[model samples]
Target: MMNIMRNSKHPVRTAAKEASHERIVSAAARAIRRSGYDGTGVADIMKEAGLTHGAFYAHFASREAMLAEAAERACTESAAIAAEAAASVPREQALTYMLHAYLSRENLEQVERGCPLAALGSETARQTPEVRRANTRYIKEMVDLVARQSPDWGQAGAHERALVTVATMVGTLLLARVVDEPALSDSLREAALKHLPIA
Candidate 1:
């Protein structure tokens, strides 16, 4: 009788715990992006999630564990944005739509909630293996999504073209953020949009 009672209550406890865990991860995701991965503090994440810092151990094993999960979540979000844009446009026009959206001033202005690769790529080299692996998986997924929308999907250079596009977009966005002058930043974005070898 006691065993049956305990088993019945297990699910409710598990669901509540999972919900709390998600909240922590989500908070970590935004925090890391807004304040670089190395800058994100544990106390800030828990406070953002409306939980005590002491509660962090319940959701994540350690700081690195939270970072890996947060990085994964951020990168997944960036890929999803590109994927959705690709799906909405005609096959031949998909790449154009993606380029427009990715290079837009709006995306550049929204650093906290924008592309993780643009925000964290340079820093990830110094991160743990788990964080690096999560970043690699998401980057591959992004490249694959771009390749699917390529005009030369089955051609000799389709995959390479897609890789170049990803690198250019990320590099351009990074440059856009670093320059002090608005004109220079706009120029970088415009030049890429104008000259990128889009097929």
Candidate 2:
């Protein structure tokens, strides 16, 4: 005799599994924001999600897998910010606003909850090949997002602008962290902001 299987209930189960997977990814995002990829261990991520370390493999092949996903999430969030910055009333104004927002004191103090470049950009190049690949894609997407918003600009213009934006934002944050001085930090951030192509 042959048996028939039901797939309706199966869909619901699949949804539940997907929800759990998202939960794990989100937990990793939060932990990574605070401790960064290398500093955040699987046990801590699972604990943050109120889960067990043993259960992690059910969602990811390894900690590296989790970092890859979390890194993408973090970078994706920054890309969204870039897109929004580009969407401001005037295209040129958008880039300038993004420049200011990205290098602000608020963003600098919250390293984990900030741009992956600012949080882990300098180190990402040294991670596993998979991580480096993921970071590269993340960066290109961010540049594309910024470019998409300012069509009044050409590809060369957009490319140069994106490079400048990323470089300034990354440099400002690193300096702020290294000097760890509020006055110097705020001034450096303003100096970067002052150089934007705001109109």
Candidate 3:
């Protein structure tokens, strides 16, 4: 028997739908960072994507599904940015460059475009498992990235050192963003940047 549905698939329509899906995910990614998961609504995401609210169902099964994808997108972006920052310097200085960039004033104020872990880590803990899974996957990738930049990349304690480095960076940024006092925020980030055991 012939498969009618398979035969009816249109490449152009598929491409267009894929583009729309990208737009929706991108918008949701920014929204989640800007507004947090609980604050991001379907209607706003759709509107930001320039999509009709009715078109959301054609892409995702539920809000949580979309949020999961969005979280993944944001994390991927954060990893890429960190990689770029590290790549711009020498091998020995890669970790230092990345640390400086992450703890910089520019990243501090760019919540919507900053690292998702620092921006949404606390909120993610209370989110659905699917969303947490997405974040966890990227968090592991980031830890590996830091480990690779270490002088003892393949050594025993490299992974543990990377874990502590990531934790400190995220914690520093999180607290920097939490305090209303600009001086305190600057101090928190500066202190972390100074004391981070980069190699």
Stretches of candidate 3 off by over 4 Å are 1-9
Regions of model 1 farther than 4 Å from truth: 1-5
Q: What overall lDDT, based on C-alpha atoms, would model 3 receive against the true structure?
A: 0.92
lDDT of 1 by residue, 1-199 (tens): 9999999999999998898888888888887778899889999888888889998898888999999999888888888888899999888898999999999999998887788888775898999998899889988987788888876786758888888888999999989988999999999999999987687
Model 1 clash pairs? none
Q: Across residues 58-94, which tens digit of lDDT does each residue of candidate 3 receive?
A: 9999999999999989988998999888889988889
* Candidate 1 residue 74 C-alpha distance from true site, Å: 0.8
Ranking by lDDT: 3, 1, 2
Which 10 consecutive residues of model 1 have the lowest summed lDDT? 147-156
Which of candidates 2 and 3 reaches a greater lDDT?
A: 3
lDDT of 1 at 185: 99
Candidate 1: lDDT over CA atoms?
0.87
- Residue 160 of model 3 has an lDDT of 90
Ranking by TM-score: 1, 3, 2
Model 1: number of backbone collisions: 0
User: Quick one: best lDDT, which candidate?
Assistant: 3
Residue 113 of model 3, lDDT score: 91
Per-residue error (Å), model 2, residue 141: 2.5
Task: Name the candidate, 1 or 2, with the larger lDDT value.
Answer: 1
Question: Who wins the TM-score comparison?
Answer: 1
